[model samples]
Target chain A: MYFGGSFSRGDFLFLLSGAVTTLSITLVAVVIGTVLGVLFGLIRAGAPWWIGNTLGAVLDVFRSVPLLIQLVLFNSFNSMLKLNWPTFTVGCICLGIYASAFCTEIVRSGVGAVPQTTRRAARSLGLTWRQELTSITLPIATRIVFPSWIGLTLGVMKDTALVLWIGIVELLRSSQIVTSRVQEPLLILGITGLIYFVMSFPIARLGNQLEKKWGTQ
Target chain B: MDYEFQWRPVLRSLPEMLWGALQTIEIAGLAMMLGTVLAIFLALAKRSGKKYLSLPADMWIETARNTPALFQIYMLYFGLGSLGLQVGSYTALLLGITFNNAGYLAETFRGGFAAVPETQTRAARSLGLGAVQTQWHIVIPQMLRAVFHAMTNQMVWSVLMSSLGVIVGLTTDLTGVTQKLNVVTYRTFEYFFVAACLYYLISKAFTLSARVVAWRLFRY
Candidate 1:
């Protein structure tokens, strides 16, 4: 009724549900991306030269290419090989893997940003390499990288909109569907953009605050 | 045992893919150029220390930074069309990317400007240099040097985001062209794989050129 048409309460609910779906996809992908990224970061940061270099090269490919292209190619490869996975599942996996590339770099650089003297100081205290990393280096590095990690979280939340291309009915696609039905693209898309802005503003604000508080450390 | 990799289709489609790559570069280059100009103004607005100017710039930066590039492009392409403000896919995509780029680069430049202490500005004023003169002669060169790496990253991001043009009916970019070839040949893997390689090469080229430019500009 707001735009001189029958914009029902159900339409709002539909978009809300779509927002829930977007959050779910972002949550699932972030969890998977974090785990894979941590593993890759550890390897790239501390593993043997050959192992680290090989993993680095693979991650470089993923990071360099566009996520949209990766999603399309992965979806096609899955169907071509008769994998027949659901679109949502394929989207989650592709997005998780795509995000893992950036996360790996963030983690690697975070760890590198930790001072070498700190590591050596821990070692001279008779700490093992594992203890030196977990108790000393990683804690400091994680603190340093917290702002970047939050930035990445906001990024993944936004990138979830791309899953619409593969027919997953997330928030952006939900708006698109409504736009098609109601013939009010501007109103629908504006509301959708506002929804996204609402979803992301708090996280970005928190990132800024954290950077302000801990960045000087 | 029967699945053989064919380079013939890839070779046959090389010219088309190359043309597509050129289009990709063209759009990204133009968007970056436009974005940088807008970013300068936005950054200056944010630094202007007045509520009216800063507030709108802040909203634009925050909104553009928060939303996905795809959403921004979709609004411009589909949403604007339905509003009867139709534009070509190329213009829609270009405007969308430039908007996002301006938001991001404004933040980067703002940070760079902040890193230059207020003491320098006061000193410039004491030396009878006007505000614009101080900014141009002292702050901007240093800020550009500080943000050269960030600008390169944004360039890569612009190139990658251009791939989304395929979804918006852009058939002239690399991804768009690759999608067309894939439909004709049913060589989805080969075509997309080659396209990915082309993207990788483009990014690497940008990285290398960025380093060279940084060296030349910041040799001091």
Candidate 2:
């Protein structure tokens, strides 16, 4: 019944804090996911048959399953393993693992898009496998996959919300807490949606711009 | 640290789990159907020369596209509940799926519509067809051809997003059943493995069917 009370000072701080937490988790997860994605992408792209297939299977299992279930499993597994990890750390790890699957696909596609001639030419120039990958293949592949990478990043940002189910005090969780305290659901939810909109809009806009630019190139 | 892995409890839950899988498919199918219609309308409206109509349609599409489906469901289910306008979890789930699907489908259809040649629309108009007639006879058919693959991608997304319904208390879906079984048996690996298999099978079926439709419709 406290309609106007939800807009009070403390509730705003609480929601803002939640937004910050969500952003921090997403940022850390994206960085780790991108690194893992690149490694997995290399395995999928240029590794030997057994290695590539093994990595491919790992990516497939992660991608095919729902994030909620993955989050739950990892949270429990962390406890069973007695890792003493914080829930936020576990949330970040789960999100990173999930994001890496999609990123690996994007990165692998990017790497594959690099013409075979480039690799052959690099080899003819006496480049080592590591040198060829770092100097030639990865650069060209990154250009090709830039748009998809951006799109996946946006997806990862939005997915940070899923951690709320595991008791992470993300934006959605904050809104729930505020609703309980002040009992103004519409305003709180509306504000939460707006906050999410703010966080997501720039990334999506950047994704579109990159796609358009890269499409022309 | 040696805990016995039991298959008996998971096996006992198979029938109910299968039932939940069916419900997940049913919900995804219905949502996709409804959302496609909404997408067509939004796509066409956005393409209409009228600025007012296109502007709001653009805003709706952008908003829905930018946010996560989980947030939308949470907003509809819990957010609306806070306003004293409680909706059934299933209804809220459907609304969320439909909303997300519509946004994605609008983009897909819009891309398809863009792929259609302007000359085709002009030719239809020159033949004395009205705007509506031009859209139906000249634009839609060609657009559908271009959108076939994109539509299949959206269907995959819808199937995946349907898993979020479990969070809002809609427990009659595959993810929900998996979660419940996981809780009871602590058989994480088995439950998630089975759920992933179900998702892959369903998505593969959709992909195959879509390919067939694409072949038939756009065969030269």
Candidate 3:
């Protein structure tokens, strides 16, 4: 005599909707995160000692703490302020900024990988700082940083699953809901895990392949 | 005039939270140690060139790599429970972190093993050593040395994942304790903020100590 085994078609659709929400959140967050990260990365790279470290200390908090705690803290702060933003809005905002903290480091490292001699030579050739960044630095750094950026995108997708803690019905939460009614956790959770695997595995393999191809050249 | 924060509740329960942080470290340390042991076998299985050995290893590694940690925790706590195997919350959380650690460290070890030159294995095999003995003596040590930095990274990730114990119904861990406090006090910001700071401090301590250890060990 086993447990309740009533996983319906509607339950599967619910999980897919959750996966869709997860993808949307990742897309928005990456857009917001990568832009802020590039801007912050450039500043961190070019700025002086005092300013950069000061900025770093603030962003380090995001990198250090678990995403769950960050989500809870941000949600709490949101409610405390009486703004009453939708949970989805709050989730996207929190995840976007959380990703920026990591993206800043990636982009800064990307910028740092551009050889000083190369930058100096760009300057020595009468290119302004802006031109050097646009022409000499950005192009090379993009090639070096492309694979890492893809990894970050995948990371943000997985991290989006944490948004369910703040009451969003993302993939994990949706599966949890179905499992509650269906009484088959392994089946439901296995399907949820497969959804994430299907979503992530291709991108991860691409990143690895790109890393290998670019690394040798 | 709203949101007058109360820090007294958090202040009063500082001892409890501190204890919770200690448990967090305990989980992370235990998971990293056990995970490293598991990762060695998984890595070897992955490279064993035998279908039966490598296939399961590949599945474990890939499944763990692809899914969210929260889902993995759910699978252990709820999924396995449905199968009539009752794992305690703490045990589930511990195993979940260990599972994650082993999955990632397996990949790192595979790369590290590859980087060990074939001649070293040949030299060991020539010295009247069997295959397993050669791996244990020469190959594993070199692999560990090469992947030491990556292992330190996985150690810190184990710390971060320890925060998930609370969600899995273990109330003795840092995040769980903090959430418990918040449920009573309704001062979500205060309790979670403190928890967040503690997490940051723990991770920083891990990386700093790892750097010092590397400095000491790799000075040559």
Candidate 4:
């Protein structure tokens, strides 16, 4: 009613629910992605040259290619194979792997970024290799890579908008539905963008702050 | 044993896909060029120490860095269309990506510029170089090297971003053409799979070419 041409409060609620769905997808994907990434990254670091490079190349395809393409391809595959999973599940599967691909790189570089001398020092000090990793390399890498991980989480949140293509009505799609019915693309899209900005701004600011603070120390 | 993929239709459309990819590459390349140019100014403005100048730059950077690129493109195409603006789909996508690139590269440039020691600029000036020459001959080379990794990431990102053209009614980009083929042939997996490989190759080509260019030009 305030700035309206028949966009009801119910429409706004619908959008809010869509935002919730986006958050849910992001949360689950981040967890799954992080775990897979950590595991693969560790394996890649110690892996033989041929295996590591091949794995890296395969993962690179996921990272370099567009997520939109992956979504469409996978969704189609799902139907073709009669997997018949819901769109949400399919989205999560693709996004989880997508996040894992990038996360693996982050972890690899982070592990490499650990000073070799420090790792050697730890190894020389009567600690096992496992102890050296846990006590020395990993902690430092985790701290160093923490900011980027946050950035990745925020990225997954934004990428969730693409799921609309597969027919899951997250935030952007909700706005699309509203606009189609109510005929106010700018107003609705602006509101949707604002919602995204609000959700992301604080986290992004935190990432920047950490990058500075942790980077210096 | 499952849903058979009909690749014949997809194979027949290779020329169309190639043309669409050419368009996508053209937009991404232009956006990167323009975005880098704009980012230089924004980076300067942010460090210019004037609130009036930096405030607007800060807002542009923050809004762009925080929002999803899809919505930005959507607004440019659909949102503006509603207002009778009627921007072309290709142009709108280009503008949106350029806007994002400028905002992101501005931040990267700011850091890269800071990495260049202040003494170097003074040294260039003392050697009788003009302001423009100092920036071009001295500052930019070092800054580009410092930020080279980030620059390549954005270059690859621009290619990845071209896929968003589908939602914006772009029929000429690789993804757009693929989506059109998808709707008609219902060979969703086959078409998108080919499109995906094309995208992978294009993005790989960009990164690999960038590496070769850097190797040829950059030195220790």
For model 2, the superposed segments whose C-alpha errors exceed 4 Å read A1-4, A48-54, B82-84, B127-130, B180-193
Best by DockQ: 4
lDDT of 2 by residue, A1-217 (tens): 4344537888888999999998899899999899999988888888898999998987877766668778877876776677869999999999998889989989999988899998999999999998998899988888888878888888888888889878899988888888887777778888888998998888778878888888787
Candidate 1's displacement at residue A203, Å, is: 1.0
TM-score of each: 0.94, 0.91, 0.95, 0.95
DockQ sort, best first: 4, 3, 1, 2
- CA error at residue A151 for candidate 2, angstroms: 1.3
Off by over 4 Å in 3: A1-5
Docking verdict class for candidate 1: medium
Q: Candidate 4's error at A130, in angstroms?
A: 3.5
| B91-148 per-residue lDDT for model 1 (tens digits) | 9999999999999999999988888888888999999999899988988888888888
Candidate 4 overall lDDT versus native: 0.91
- lDDT accuracy of residue A196 in candidate 1: 89
By the DockQ metric, which is better: model 2 or model 3? 3
* Deviation from native of the Cα of residue A160 in model 4, angstroms: 0.9
* Model 3 RMSD, rounded to 1 decimal: 2.2
Q: Give the candidate order by descending lDDT.
A: 3, 4, 1, 2
Model 1: residues with Cα > 4 Å off, grouped in runs: A1-5, B1-5, B123-128
- Chain B TM-score (each prediction, in order): 0.94, 0.92, 0.95, 0.95
